[model samples]
Target: MKPYNFRRNPKPLTPNDIENGKNFNEVLKAAGKPPLITPSALKWMGIGLSSLAVLLGLYFGLSNNTEPETSFVQPLGPVPFTSALINPEKDTLLHLSTGSTIFIPAFSVVNKDGTPSKGPVEIKYREFRNVGDILLAGIPMTFDSNEARYHFESSGMFELLAFSGDNPLMVAPGKNITVRMASLNSKDSYNQYYLDTIAKNWVPLGKDNKLFYTGDSVEVGNLKGQNLSKENWEPIKPVVLNPKAQQFRIEVDPKEFPEIAVFGETIFEVVPSEIAYDPATAELPWSDVSIERTAEKDYFLISFSGNGQTLKILARPVVSKSNYVKEMARYEELYKNYLRLEKLQAQSGPTAILEKELSRYKALENQRVADMERAAFVEGRNNTNKSVVYSVFSVQQFGIFNSDYPLKLPNARILQPVFAFENGKQIPATQYFLAEMGRNNLYTFKGGDKIQFDSEVSNLLVVLLNDGSVGLFPASEFGKIPSHAREYKFVLEKVETSELSSKKILSMFNI
Candidate 1:
């Protein structure tokens, strides 16, 4: 009746049992006595099962929850949109920090239901100016025309969006918004295009009008006088005494001609001209006699009118023989004082007093030829500073718009370009971009595709690697490639994701 110890002394298998394939556990179960496991052993088994479950949960959880793939068209850096609140019922003129202007007419924005948008509307705008801006914005510069693909050489580009509260708005039918985009390129070679987001293409929107600044003309003659040196300053000549000529003393108002008032007593001597002045006309108690300066130096146009008759004659200011010697001494003293005051003013820098003094004597200097030449020079200079060229266009929809011209890609091609680091380590790239120095466009090529570029033009090669790092083959290296090479290996400078930035990318290409 003793219990069989299966671990120590188990029953020997019979020939029949062996033929029936009964193992040790089956034999023990059939004998009505099963092996027993202790609580400690069960506890250890539960812990082992739990550990396996936790390990499996971690593995599947990590496999299910992974970071999303980054968008290829996403901007490289932060480009914040400028927002403005505008009343949709009233005409609004929005001015951006870039000196561009947008004219939104009344009732231009409509709701999705085709009803006029009311109350305040939000306008979000941004501009792309330079190559860095365009690259950071991730805007596609390629255009398709007549079954051929061309790149867009942008002059200026902008994005405009409208919203009402949390809902998006659209342009009202038959209404359009006018945009005057401040452009750096003043040339009229660019045309307008509207980006179709859903279609992912740009549609032609006709030619853009390039408007230049037209303001008041700058008077170069006045500026020249104010900018003259003391050595170039010319003093007024002393009045000549012609006693033999028909001369008479006349009092000129000091306020009317302060320049003439500087001279002590002014005598008017009639110059011989086609029209002779009658002495009887001088004593006829003239109703009105006016004196004004003529084109000639020291010459005045004198007109006398009375009893419905008018007489016009050229007269020159003169001094009497008796007063000549005294006036000459007075002139020398005044001239010396004028020179001393001018030197003092020049030392004090440009001031209202100096400008007034210079302007008062500008009429006395004979500088017509010099003034004309300076005027042309100054006009050209002021055109750059005082005026801005604008690319004017009207949009019926709110989206990205560009003033651009389509340019064809280069005919030269290199098939299956192998991109590698400078140390000859091969790296895989997702996309490649070729940017010419003068063109505003960026030509994109897929990996393992043919790379086309102009050899004569300065070209910059940029590759987006599979690991999100940037690789740069600068314009200098691009120029060194031989024209006859069919297969090309691009030696690039690696730019890690942490160091990838708009400024760094621009500097690599020396933009």
Candidate 2:
């Protein structure tokens, strides 16, 4: 039939044509429209698909930008043993040099009856030599509270004495040694003034020899330890001799001694020039006198040999007293002023100007007290050698206060014993559980009971309880403890088994 209708019919439809037709119908049904395929139609379809892809890409990119990124980090391992100790290098202690040590001797004072004396006995270093005011001439000695004993650069002398008002009793009279000889040159009229000054202040040796010659020899000894009121002397009897007896005299020139210058009644000390001794003659030989004590009389006998003959002379030592009544009255007045100023200072409120005035008054008062103490020696000739020492028991160190917190122990390993309550009784932790928990001999707190701590020195006290809690206290507060309620007890919380396991793994890896 197709051959007969070749003109109208295209060669008979093949299997490919039928399959194409089925595909065309399926595409048309799915699209709900007639399916058309052309070069222009393909270009429009590709452009639509590109726009949709770009829109989808932009939507996803914007959503990603708004959302926060998440990251995962591994946990830290167990702490190292070296990082957990308290370092000694960080301690705040007053460290002394190696091999340095301080030592103080024990001292005490006693009365005449060998009982403890109830008075303040001051011990100080001797500052000046003979005749000078000690307080005015010296500096006050300063000392550290931590010092055990005073350091001695050389063998030093100390004055130990107790003041009885402004008077001083000759307890241990220290010695004052001097070998002085000088010559004085004065005007004729000034000589009488000098003599009067000497007679008023010093004790003269001879009865008729008050006006001494130029070449007189004078000897004086033991002027210290004298009374303050009266002169005590054992008079010497004049020597009586026969007509054939040779006469010899040891004369001292008044000009060859300590001199005095006077204007009206006021006298002043004058330094003198060099001295000279008159040559001894056969008639008046200068012999060394042998001092002999006699039971017949209350005086000393001096014997000598001159011109091939034996001779003797009488001698006596005088103990003179100096008057300090006026000086003592002045010191008492100064002490009253000092007390007044001190009371005023205590009563006044704190102010810079007032404080400055108080300070000035205090300094003046202290100087007056020191001067009074010094004048005691000069007024009474009371030496300090006879005084006894006394013992003083006082605090050697100062305490520290708490409130300084968060103490860290870097190198110190302080472990305490751990206790547990079982059957209402305190019991120590078992070794098995301690090993399982990875603990040492550390004390643990378990709720009840009071704890007391006494610190002997400045130190940091670290306490770690079983519940993984910690506490810190300063050395000062340790003594005042029981300061908290129920004394001090440890409280701790148990850690989870999983945490413990993780810790164990970290520890294993760490080693």
Candidate 3:
């Protein structure tokens, strides 16, 4: 049977002489089968060529991502202080600082003159916990501190976003700055490495002291006892992100158990496993020491900024080493006595009154559990302040005692300005101010400020400048801060901690 044949319509072409076309085909056929090629071989060749093209394209495309196609012409101005860019993951970006910061997620970093620098911050994107991933994107970094501005030239492949909020210094212009690599890779540093490449930069705070180098800004100042390689080569330390961003007015919550944190010196401020337990014994302050005990169930901390401005999550519910058993041992022993005495009701018969007494013993046992719950120092996640809470210290500033713990200072009316921030964007509902008892002191300060003497409690002297500027001069640079500094910034001075004599209480019992 003849099958119906179908053919696609041929595309129109310039008509050629049939005779000439046949002659050409005949001549070619006569030429030893014309070295015909197989369709499979042709297909493989096409595929190989295509794969090679893609590989070459990707190599050059990534390498030349940010590089200018044009020759090294006149360099472009720096990215504008106000301009910003973010990575594909939507992390905020930054650049040179005029002394402020911003939190908007941006994409490309434009120059001050409105142009992007040549070259794709060509870093591969990937991420690793101990190490970051490759194929990361780009990130803009900018900050201003002291008198210098720092700019970072970087790719955000695995990079993290530094813009958490408003920072005036990050957006401010006017300083020499350089971004280093060590600030980006330390286990404690801020940025995340997406894949293989790291893109970043740093801007210094002063004109003459702008950052002169950068590689992977490590931010190594906070890592103590850590043997980290500087940018993998140089023996330099990374600087803190916001070493001196001051907040004029701030607030805090004292009842809020603070989540342990360390800014410029340590990795973690609190280690839950290191929690110390009180003695594991129960005493009635009398001769009664017998009691039953129970096992501790769980433990945690709920720290809050003063005034409930912020609620921070601390330790989760975890098994904690506790003395709950030893302390409650007395309850069991007393209850047993009451029960044993009941069996004697037929013999000596004191069960009724004894049961009542036994009840009291049981009550005490229950009290221990209540005490354990009350033993919590901080609040819980259930109760959080919806206001902004700026971290504050108990004392304005606390320094060293004698030589090592010495707090250095220059002539200024104010000795310590601990709770100060530059731009706004703070934890709401928190408040702060310089606390000068009964009266405020005036002072002045300048570069090269140092300590003269060291005394922990001796008050500093205030020096009036010829220009009407007041300065605080540390009388003893080696003095210790007020004792009992537990968290952000509160301390108990010797005077505050001193107990006073009581008379009414002494007479309450007719003593």
Candidate 4:
């Protein structure tokens, strides 16, 4: 076989090899070697490719994650709770610093098993009076009625709870506690509502009766007291003839000196003992004399002035001896009546106060008895008076109660907001709040939600940013937004959560 060459004829260079521009030497070297990739090398190559695929997958997965990092429904700080201890065996009246009052009837609280609870049950109460308080408390102010959602324009809102030795107590059946909640808003349009925690909704009770007094009524009561004080009159002193003292008679003007107007034909007697009076001043030939009332009752500052010089003397009004005798006789009878009236008032003042307090409890007791007889869950009475405005409600359960009017969101303008920092850095917000300047309603919304508000009304927007900072769109900017604009871009001012306070937040909203 012609000394057969051990090297098999190298495969003929294919068209692909020529097109690939492979040199003849490289092709020959490739043919002479065993297959460059062995099983072991292939295994290693497979492992390397798998590792690269996993790293790429992880990179894309994290980049696409869109979940919120943190959600904050409440304010940064804790909401404080006020507590008071009360004996369940007796009716207790609790007063709060906010001027709210709670009247708990005897045996109103019961054990979980429905038996009456004993000992001093601690009553815990708190109030949310402003936008900041409500937001910090995370209390929902929205009301859903008849498939329509509304916001609560609150007059006042409060929460109440009772406990005994760390055990929660329930309100006794057929019994209710009365709450006289002081309200800043004196409007009569609000209705009472109790928050149903289990259902997470507000249950409308009825119209809230507002008790308030007019300024005219208060003035009438004050006038009656003034009239009584005027009825108890005293006699004036008679003018005594003194050879050394100078005295003069003057026709007193009723309008100018109304204090001594009742005494007819009065004479001005100089009081030498007064420190402000100078006896030498009486000798001046005064061109004009003017009388000015002094701090002392029935006394006057008699001034004589002429040629740019003024002389003032202390003087008092006095009646003649005969007039004094006639006035004194009438005064004696009036004084006797005044003494009798004073004695009666002294004896009755404390008794009247005690009776007034007792009457309140008695009235409450009567109402409680009547409610029990009818087996009613709640009972309310309208105790209107000329005093403070009180929004009263009776609760058969321990929970949050509110006096509010449900208001629909303003539909004059609707917007889809895109929140960004003043520096144009976009922030993701999970929730936001809208507060109108004059209205006590707080409208809240979720992310990707449409915000509807009246453009004419001053409004404030607050958003809890994803980076754990507060973003505020102030009220001043509300007027700058075009009414017809649908998509609004809000340039927010970033505020550190630590620097925020209830007063500061309220001031920002102009509450």
Candidate 5:
């Protein structure tokens, strides 16, 4: 069988052609030699033609196998062109008072074909915390040829979500920008970093502020003193996450420990850890200490010299070192002043003026002692302890001093009633306000106040009152009040910290 060939003569063989071939063969015979179309020659031609056909088919098949075949790839879906995108290069932790802005580089939404994807880009933001993540409004970013921008007004971790219409295109890791107190100078400031078990990384918080971490532990100390860089951080203690509870309110029932009765009309308040009191004035008359925990383990019964009054305090489980630091400074200053006054009194003895001045100095001297006791009580946080708690004794009675009173009861109020504004209304004592706390300024509008400002232009104000109350309010500027606001419009509601003496006694003894 001859191999099929397309490129050949168009005309088919005819009988005249065969006859011409036979005449040519006869001429070749007249010259000499055998006939041209012999049986052996025909047989050899058939075998040779068959072998050629097999070789041609094998050559084409092997050539196809040597090189890869080209085909179109069906895209899984529209892909975000992350290759050209860049995240924020600035440090996530910010100490800006007016807040900060971050720029997200322009990135294209491309399809499998490497062409720009069809649809509008939407950017969403939210406040990130260890316990709860707050979701904010999603706005369509003003794309300047694919780039977008964002700003933060408060301190916290913020996350970004970018989408091409309904489909999620990309998500940016949390970008943290913290706003600090405007009055505070950052030259001497430092941050306390914690181990974020959720993220498996170390996170930073302002050293002066109290925070609730959901992680197993957090490392806290002066970054410089500890020689801790971001990579070398470690946890100071394990953090027990209280998901359902955010704060604890401190309440005192003096009847349980009536031994504290000598201090009549005594108002109790929880002091911050920062205060240092005079030691001589802080001596306790009673002498047994018994600390117990409730069944739910939410509250602790801290009895000082069990013989004294037992105060029931509800407080979150977290300690703040800033309080202790501040109190120590006050303690040292007052002690030095008291020593100088004593020397002056000795030099100018027997005079009425010197005596009166000495008496006043003595009162201040007693208060400093109380401060030291309170500071010591709150600053003792073991690895398993929760938050810091203390009591300040303010005397309402001015008569002769009672010998039974717990040595020298401090004249200062540690825990003041904190107020908050929720849903455009004033709410009382919602958050346990820490005394001597500082932050960026904020404002709060009480009922009946017609003050109005462009909410868009207004910022939060950190209001620190003389009574040691700190709160956030909506305002226009840091120090000034909002415009169109009356001077007396802002009502500072009195924080009711404790129950009446009679009522507390009755409840304690079940009268």
Candidate 6:
């Protein structure tokens, strides 16, 4: 090789050398076009995709946010009945104080009977002194199908003789005890009105009077069950007689008197204040507080500042008697209108009576609730208690329906289960299951045929077969029934499980 000129002479180039030094513009001219994308172009595309991702995230992230409503309702303190509002704190307070009763305050007092329950219906705390209204006697009792209530009505006379009810005061026409004197006072707690009496110088004629009134008084709860007997009325102190007492209340502990229970010992206080209640409905759906029956009366003796306490007196049915007088009073007032309207839109006397009883304060337009109840009560009093009970049942069902679904049991572990037919297997022979079956078409079982359900069998229950009926007898009482049907079909109509009644099952059907 010749001696190279260091600065001027380039090296004799290889093919790689020529390609490396070549201008990009010249190369593009040689090739048809440049490569598809430059580095800058790729960078821009990635940036664009990143921006799109960012936008999507923002949209989804904000989607959960909501605009609140402009306004909301504020509770105006306690509602009409002061007793109804209960501070949840009362529960805690009850546990803290054992000497004083943990008052339930006011709850939904569902009426037990339809005929306006009459007073003088007694819940006997003892032989001599009557406590409260157990089952008011003559109060024209009936169910208002429309209102769904057990209505106590008046039968012209206030005492049991005319149309009596269970007397709250056990005193009667000519008994050992005599009411020497009586006084009455009318006062009300809300828009609701009330009346009560005060007795003085009452005497018992029998020799046992001393023992009946005196002696060691039974403890609060025990006094109810003919628990004690005493003599010497002067020294003994009775709850009703002590006028200037603190609370004017009856304090009883449930632990002692277990016999009188509500809802089968689970609960007992079944006082129905508004309209109607079921012996079946022992416990409230919303409340789990256990209640017990005290003297079978529906009234509550709520003690306050002194012995003069609030008496939540039971409403008696004066409907039948009152309705007659009501009509007679307003006969001429609406008769001409009835004549003009052909009685198609006549004003019956019950309208006024209803207005007086339920919708006294609320305007007629807004008093549809009270008005409807009155009309229904009047209509049903003449019929059966079934109609009245059905209405109350409907309301209870409605309450249950509107409430949170799938009611849970008192013990959270076990759910409140409704019995339903699972397998095609049979059930315990009971009256309701086949109440309305026709008398003509039914099977009668012989002694050997009794199907006993035991642990061994696990599934079968003994059934009693009878004319036009089928009964599900509990396996425990096997085969002793001479002639029985687990179910029934009565004379007036066909019976079905849906039509069974407790009274009928025990009384009419001989279940």
TM-score, one value per model: 0.52, 0.16, 0.15, 0.52, 0.18, 0.16
55 Cα displacement, candidate 2 (Å) = 99
Candidate 6 lDDT over residue span 170-254, tens digit each: 2222211111100010011001001111111111111110001001111111111222211101111111211221121133343
Model 4 worst lDDT window (10 residues): 215-224
The whole-model C-alpha lDDT of candidate 5 against the native structure comes to 0.27
| Candidate with the larger lDDT of 3 and 6 | 3
Cα deviation in Å at residue 190, candidate 3?
Answer: 12
lDDT score, residue 347, model 6? 45
Which portions of model 6 show Cα errors greater than 4 Å? Answer: 1-85, 90-102, 105-494, 509-511
What digit string (tens of lDDT, one per residue) describes model 2 on residues 248-365?
A: 3333222221010001111111101101111233246545544433221222234555446554343322211122343344335554654665566568645576466456644544
Candidate 4 clashes: the total is 0
What are the C-alpha RMSDs, in order, of all predicted structures?
35.0, 46.5, 32.3, 34.2, 39.2, 36.5
Candidate 5 residue lDDT tens string, 71-132: 11111111111111222221122112122222232233333344443454443332221101
Model 5 / residue 129 / CA error / Å:
16
What's the lDDT for candidate 2? Answer: 0.24
- For model 3, residues 232-314, the per-residue Cα lDDT tens digits are 11111222222222111112221121111101121111112212311111111222211110010011223323332332222
Q: Give lDDT per model, in order.
A: 0.64, 0.24, 0.22, 0.64, 0.27, 0.21
Residue-level lDDT for 478 in candidate 6: 28
Candidate 4: pairs in clash:
none
